[model samples]
Target: MTPTALTPPLMTPAQRKLGMVLCLVTIVLAVLDMNIVSAATVPIVRDLDPVHGVDRLPWLVSAFALAATALLPLYGKLCDLYGAKRVLLGAVGTFLLGSGLCGAAQSMDQLIAFRALQGIGGGGLMSVTMVVVAHLKDPEDRGAGRGGAMGGIVAGLGMAIGPLVGALFTDHLSWRWIFYVNLPLGLLVLVGAALVLKLPATAGRRSLDFLGAALAAAFATTLLLVTEWGGKDYAWTSPEILGLAAVAVVTLVLFLWRQATAAEPVLPLSLFRIRVVRLGFAVQGLVGMGMTGSIMYVMLYLQIARDVAPTTASLYLIPMAAGMTAIGLLVGRLTSRGHSPRTFLVAGAACATLALVLLGLSGPTTGLWAVCAELALLGCGLGQLIGQLITLVQEAAPAHQLGVATTGIRFFQTLGSALGAALFGTLLARVFEAGEPGEPLGAVRSLAGAAREHALGSFTDAVDVVFLSAGGVLGLVLLLAVRLRATEAAAGVGEEDRPVLAA
Candidate 1:
């Protein structure tokens, strides 16, 4: 069936506005939950005091990411099978339930379990929100102008505000308030969605790809475990890491084989045949790795090497956020006016690469203003790249497969984050250990002045290495962006469907 035939009618102005508002709200909450919790970790650890010690603290974050990443593909398929509204509402409700439970948890284990539940809902929120927004716009309105601007603003704002909001909750109220805060906002989103969202009815019953889902989940979980544990909890060459790697390889092969043969594959392999779609995923993955790794390492550099407070270090990111917000909105507007996305994509990649190179060359003697300016450039590149990529994928995908295609881009990005964390962490640890063997920086603070200087220098050197490596990755992204086709399409729904109107 043609995608246009499957699309419901365009939404009325009121319905479209309300629906977009609901999508934005849910996305902000989901993004906030990911970062806000980072600031509250110390308080959480003090209160729960897991018997295994603070070493297991990373699991609090990893558990959520693992569940969210593994379930994203499944959620996309479910949205297509049922309806976007139904699936989205379910996801919101589930996330709210998880948030409440997390706030009330009495043990570290319980908190981790609740986080995994939250991730299940969070995954759907991000994937379905984009699907909802795409459906809201008429094909004629899908150009880079307003559509691009809205998406860019949404992405930039949600990410930029997360850490700041988390810090606010942690400093002014109980750390638990971070989770509890979601309740009121999430309830509002749920009620609003129920009243305003209207999409096409399900076509018919289709068999679930249960086997494919299982294989895919297994593969994702194994890979996440390898990334999270290798070289930290266990040696890279240790039996545990090697065994998990083997399982990941085997499950991936099985998952691909099942997709090719399944009556209803969880992720349709045919989507990869589209040239733009294929390139989009690749560029998205690389950008994800570079962006995530750079953000993390920069924070560490500010806090450890530059002797800045955590809160102060976070404030320094303002310039980057500003650059991202401004450029993202501008590109969206420009693209809507019929400009080629490839232009923004290539330019953005170049900016991102240049920012990383600047950062790598910076030292303790470098001015703070200079660092902030470099970060702003990085933000501009990311803002343009991310916003345009979403538009391109949606434009390229068939309406029937819109949900899956959108979620697929997110899936690759999430995978890239996992890989980036693992890669950067390993590199930093090796460099630090080689320079200051058996002496952690925190432990050496009480030592003589000379020893302290040595520890600080080692950390600075490690940060430089990480930044240089990340810059190289962004350089590759620039090459990929240049190869992208400079085509434009106006995405819209057909007349067979009717727009939902306010009562």
Candidate 2:
């Protein structure tokens, strides 16, 4: 079926506004939870002091990320089977329930399990919100295009504010309040969605591809494990890491085969045949890696090398947040005017690469303002790319495949995040090991003289290497963006028509 036929009718202006608000609020909640815990980690570890050492602390974040990433495709399929509104409401409710449980947890194990539950809900919040926003638009109406950009802004804001919010809660009330804070905001979204969201109900029954879902989940989980553990917990060539890598490869191959053969695939293979859709996912993955990896390491550099407090380190992201928010809004407005998204994509990639290059050249003696300027440039570049890419994919997809197409992009981006963290972390670890020999960086911190200076210098060099590598990846993204047909504008397809791929 064509995309227009599958798209629901547009809502009235008031309803549309309310629906967009709900989508943005829910998305912020989901995105906020991902980063907010960063500042709270110390407090949580202190309070819950489980038997496992501090090494297990990473799981608090990883569990939520893994669950969210693994369940994205399934949530998309559910949105198609049920309605977006139903799936979204259920997701929000589940997230709130998990939040409550997390707030009350007295042990690390319970918190990890509850976070995973929250992540399952969080996954649906992101993918389904996009689906809902896509439906808010009439196929021919460019006016509704702002919804995509708004979503992008909300996501950026959530990421920007998470650490500051976490620090506030941890310092003033308790670490648990960070989770509790979601209750009121989430309830507001739930109420608004219930009152304002009006879409056609699911009229016919369709069989879900359970086997495809299971294989896809297994593949994603194993792949994440390989990335997370390869060089950190085990040697890259060690039996455990190698076995996980092998399993990931096998499961991914099987998942692809199943997609081609399944009656209703979790991720339809045909979607990749569309050039824009294919390239959009690729760009999203690369962007995810570069963007997230840079942000993470930058935070580390501030805290570790510069001795900035966690809350203050988060404040440095203000420039990035501003750049992204401003550029995203502009791109969204331009999209409504039928601009060539490829232009923005190419420009964004170029800017991002330049920003990374600047970051790589920065050092211990570099001025703080200069670094912040580069970060702003990085944010602007990413802001231009992200919202535009979402618009391109949604515009290119066939109506019936909208949810799948949206979720497919997110799935790759999430995978990119995992891969980026692992790859960058491994690179830093190897560099640190080579330079420091027997001493850990933590141990070096306790030294008072030349040992401390040498270790910090080594850490700085390692960070520079990561920045340079990330720059190289962004350079590749630039090439991919340039290859996309610049003539392909963000225009509407007819009810009976499918988007034409450029030759």
TM-score for each model: 0.91, 0.91
Give a tens-digit lDDT track for model 2, residues 309-397: 86788888888888888887887778678766677778888988999889988887889999899999998888776766776787777
Lowest summed-lDDT stretch of 10 residues in model 2?
A: 494-503
lDDT of each: 0.81, 0.81
After best superposition, candidate 1 residue 320: deviation in angstroms?
A: 1.7
Tens digits of lDDT, candidate 1, 1-503: 53343234545777877787788788788768877887888888888984563876888998889898999888888877887888899999999999999999888989999999988888888788887777776546663434445555666676678777877888898888899999999999999988888777766756779889889889989998999899878999999999999999999999999999988888899877776778889988998899877899898889877778888998877788788789977886677677877788888889999999999898867888999999999989887777577777776766667778888888898888788989989898888889999986566445668887788888888888898899999899898777665422232232222222111
User: How many clashing pairs in candidate 1?
Assistant: 9
Per-residue error for 64 in candidate 1, Å, reads 1.1
Give the TM-score (vs. native) of candidate 1. 0.91
Lowest lDDT sum, 10 consecutive residues, model 1, at 494-503
Show where candidate 2 strays beyond 4 Å: 50-53, 138-140, 143-145, 201-205, 432-444, 447-451, 487-503
